[model samples]
Target: MFLYTENFEGQKEMAMAGLSRALAEDRVDRDIIPLLEKINALDNYFTTSSCSGRISVMEMPHFGDKLNSVWLGKWHREVFIEEVFEAIGRHRSGQLWFLVRSPILHVAARTMDDAVKLLNLSIGLGFKYSSIKSVSHRKLLVEIRSTERMDVPLGEDGELWVSEEYIGRIVNLANAQVRRFKGKLKRLEDEIEVLEK
Candidate 1:
């Protein structure tokens, strides 16, 4: 048997409550809900946060300025080139960027052994960036994440730098990435029950 962190049950309960609230508010990603439910059903784990990956066009005051960033368009599934153009049309005064991010899940494990088991499983499922994020008597956190991503600068200050052809090419690439990660998520969801053994 594994030794769990102090107040692990209490923490799991609180996390579940938070997840319920997020669901009620439509803040949780739809594609990731089934996977999250499977993980949460286990005795040793509960998810704290997650994203089912996304393709987005964003505007920011400057590079790496997340606080001032505004999303012109965001999609959890694959997108069309025309949709991309529409988002670009909304861009005003800021640095515009096109981005694709892979799926990420932050899980709180009941113990270090559980954490490592989940981390290894996630890495094997193509979440190459999976790792133990933090360890303490209060919590053991694991980050399950993939490496597929793209950050392309589109323009600045209401200026368009890339052509429509260029945007089309990047849109194709982003869609491919979206398909790839969705496959991985499916595999992980199918295999998650193995952790119980």
Candidate 2:
């Protein structure tokens, strides 16, 4: 049985509840305890963060062959999102580098709406102007400068490469959202104080 919260606060509360429930349900299932512990710890990281970084991270395969469309399955998306959530729950700073299949950039940046929509999504996901970068161009490969944990590299034969750098950026992007949210909280606090006086 898995229960997640609607957001960070709920995550924290549910994690605590999960811990109690797990402890009672299986005194011998020690493994469940550790999982609950980890989830509980994530509360601090998640609560401190203001917005969610729902990244549209993608990658291309077979740039040298006939493959043109970026292939991302439903299960792949879920795992990616879960991995990102955990990564963000781990760190306080970093960039969210979206490793798309080298050609999504052309598709994403083809129109004004596309670029605007991307930026809007980034803002909604807690971007700090400087924390977003995209790596593309299969034929014109540029060396990526990152100390990430997850990297998915696609070869000429179309083998997806996953690395740490990609994973690390989730934390970075989430930290950015936290900072943005904190600012909003401060403003609200100040306004409330003024009204009280």
Candidate 3:
């Protein structure tokens, strides 16, 4: 049988440098900083990227055109229906969407065992979509995620496709999803210390 090996020391040096640059640039999300700190404090792991989850109303010229897309309103926490209405009013041209996204954290573990441990713990903490995202000699990455999500079209070209009542209903639904994912994030944050054991 053939065996595969990895240079964890080299990977750690690269990851540490990357993290330092990201921190110096203020690229890490503000809300997730505390959790990132806690995780980095552990010896066997580091973070590559993360988003603490969000609910947003976006205006775009077309689907997937991120270069021109504008966030009419965005909130990292739960949103109010009135806020959605305000965002909708700002749409001048193109499509409008109300979206709810689950929390996501990409963590790099020092070894396969460490990656698996983090993956299992995330899944157990209601991050049902968690998985080992990638594995190679350079890195073993675990992606912590949840199931909550929504992508609803509310209008296009400065018009409203749905009634205000319908918008309200969708807002409530998105809020529910936001609350659900936030709880998962909190649980993960609380339990992430287990990796140190």
Candidate 4:
């Protein structure tokens, strides 16, 4: 996937470009409306932070970097693989985790690897990201987290963490996962049936 950023484009617009690219790919067969919803959840964070007053356009600069860049990273890009990137030197690496329990995901995930590559990274929804460490799954049975990026305490350098909120926004991700899963399983079942014929 390629990255595209515009001077005046908004977050949704930038995300839509990625969504459109993903949707237009010939390799993507099944519908992605549900997955798109999951993607939209990411945008919700912006609105929530703004409304909750946890974030401000003025304070953003002190917290994160490059808030104005319109990122157009591919679904499989790794520039922002995880909440943070680890690795000495100029290279940084991170992990992407999602609940594959959804039936739809089962199908779409047939050819997918355990991890997703992300790029066109953006920071600043109100959090301090310095010397990013690791991106591991949270302890929740059905939820996930970016172990590295977190909310800092009263005076700490960084301690911010995104969990319940992120999970809540992505509640429907499982739907697509389930749908894809079942679809692929059905295809396999159909192949078996054809083989018998």
Best by TM-score: 1
Minimal lDDT window, size 10, model 4: 48-57
TM-score of 3: 0.88
lDDT of 4 by residue, 68-110 (tens): 3212222211122232212111211221222122121211100
lDDT (Cα, tens digit) per residue for candidate 1, span 39-136:
99999999999999999999999989999999999999999999999999999998999999999899999888899899989999899999888888
lDDT for 48 (candidate 4): 8
TM-score, one value per model? 0.97, 0.21, 0.88, 0.21
lDDT score, candidate 2: 0.31
| Better model by lDDT: candidate 2 vs candidate 3 | 3
Better of 2 and 3 by TM-score: 3
Sort the candidates on lDDT, descending order: 1, 3, 2, 4
By lDDT, is 2 or 4 better?
2
The regions of model 2 sitting more than 4 angstroms off are 1-162
lDDT of 3 at 168: 84
lDDT string for model 3 (1-197, tens) is 11122665666667678878988998766778788888877878887788988889999999889899999998888778888899999999999988888889888887788888999999888999999888776668889999998889888999999999998888888878878887777777788898888
Give the deviation of candidate 2 from the true structure as CA RMSD: 18.2
